[model samples]
Target: MSENLFVKWTILPQEPPQPLLYCKRCGGTRNFRSSGKIRVNANGKRVDAWLVYKCMSCDGTWNRPVLERQSVRSIDPLLLASLCANDAKLADRLAFDVEGLRRWAPHLKEASNAVVARELLSETPARPLELRILCVVPCHMALRLDRLLADELRIPRSRIHALEKSGALVVFPSASRALRKPVRDGTKLLIRPPAEDADWIARSAAYGDDCP
Candidate 1:
């Protein structure tokens, strides 16, 4: 109806995905979390490294290989040093690797928990009629797009669906089942509401303190 009020939402997943593996002590499959420890072994010119994982149920441990007898010459010295020193950031990044976690277990119990950092990318209007949200994900997280919007807007997913049904909410640059699936980078949403509802939704989208 007017120049869109553009806003950016940066989402960061809080927890890493847990790999479910059978634990003999627990007598069943259990989730394993990263121990934030790295083990490196160097034999001649070959190097092997792993990120340690611990079973949540029994304190049992598993090692996820980061390097497999790689040639020292082929590896970056900095990366090798980080692996040896047990760099927390490097370990966290590796631990959050959902695709890599698939090696141990095809299915993972991924956390939907995340924090959204919002910013206004365009000028605010006195009576805003349109709001566009741009989702920015630094790393892959398992949070659904609708869940994210509901969380930030402080509303129920059912309300979001209602808006969609009324043609007030439009999700673009997305495929089918976008709402049910995990949020991805560059996902955009356009919201157009009646004049009376525009101000409230805009404030909520921008996280205004006065929002209902």
Candidate 2:
């Protein structure tokens, strides 16, 4: 029987990416924070909407368009109402839309706080562990797979490299270079640790609040 342990990890960005935009009032580029507000304008049957952001340095307001000249009927009623009410979650989703933010703030600065949530996916500990990584939200996180593993497994990154080279650590899609690439949702990692290192892996920070 193959003893394969399965675990799942969800990567969540703690905060929305704040776009760095030029603030006319501040006379320079400044980080803009989501004001958690939406502004809408109606013209005929067209609706235009924007998520409002404010410059941290001077409180200057900038409207990042969420929808432009969209047909009123095409908009979901609940979403439309949420926009009208300035719903926090809706505003957050829009704020995290890096592609949308780029339209206006072409040179926008983006960052993220990568918070990982882990779960045990199997009842038995297999000889080789198959770890499934799921991203909970979309954001520009700088986290790399190797870094996350090092932090979670409480092991040195060099150890991770050795495992990869020895074919003990296998990343799915074979062609994927997860070690150096930014961690993405739906990436899977298969790890075969040395028997002596099993205890250390079992006590990984993934199971505790002592995240590194």
Candidate 3:
């Protein structure tokens, strides 16, 4: 059985959404609105609201304030996975280990937050082969199925299970037909893409996904 654990933390001072107003630079009545949660100091002394907005007509910048209060919630695996899916930066920061946790725990975060890593033994006559592939997509690049396949060697989610059912996509080592799982950190992925794809991959890979 595999075990998992997740570390929990809270972002305090919930922020409420605000309305847009006219821009002085553009003299335009229409304005864009943006919002973000409020952050408090560690000592719980200071509090502030923050938001970023840009004018549509003249490309002007606007900042707004939010005022609201919220309570803290427990951190769970599902929430962590959602964070990983939507915001890699926050996911990297919140994930941590729980000592003495079961190995097969479903909520476990990756060890050392190394989402991609493999361990192989050579002397064990017949050792399991674990291969990990990490695909880094640029934030600016649009997500597309074909682009994912050409780089990650994994079929799109829409075709993954179907291909596996028909025995078209086989897992390596055992030749079992299945979609290739995502690669975590520390795993070497075979990257083969055209010039344009290479450019995006190179740019996204420049930044380390792990928390600082």
For candidate 2, which ten residues in a row score worst on lDDT? 128-137
Q: Which stretches of candidate 3 lie over 4 Å from their true place?
A: 1-48, 55-57, 64-142, 154-167, 170-212
The TM-score between candidate 1 and the true structure equals: 0.90
Every model's TM-score: 0.90, 0.82, 0.24
Q: How many clashes does the backbone of model 2 have? A: 4
Which candidate do you rate higher for TM-score, 1 or 3? 1
On lDDT, the stronger of 1 and 3 is 1
Candidate 3 residues 36-149, lDDT tens each? 222222124323322344455666655433212322233344543443243434322222212211121223222211121212212211121221233332111122323333
Identify the runs in model 1 with alpha carbons over 4 angstroms from their true place: 1-3, 208-212
Q: Rank the candidates by lDDT, best first.
A: 1, 2, 3
Instruction: Report every candidate's CA lDDT.
Output: 0.85, 0.74, 0.30
- Error (Å) of candidate 3 at residue 188 is 18
Q: Model 1: clashing residue pairs?
A: none
Best by TM-score: 1
- Cα lDDT tens digits for candidate 1, 59-173: 8988888999999999999999899899999999999888887886786888799877889888777778788999898777889888887877776899888888788888887
Candidate 2 lDDT by residue in tens digits, 1-212: 44555667777666666788779998998899889899999899999999889999999999988889999999999988998888888988888777777778876655534677777665444344443333343465667778878877878999999989998888775655778776765667777678888646754623635423
Q: Which pairs, if any, clash in model 2?
A: 3-126, 3-127, 4-126, 5-126
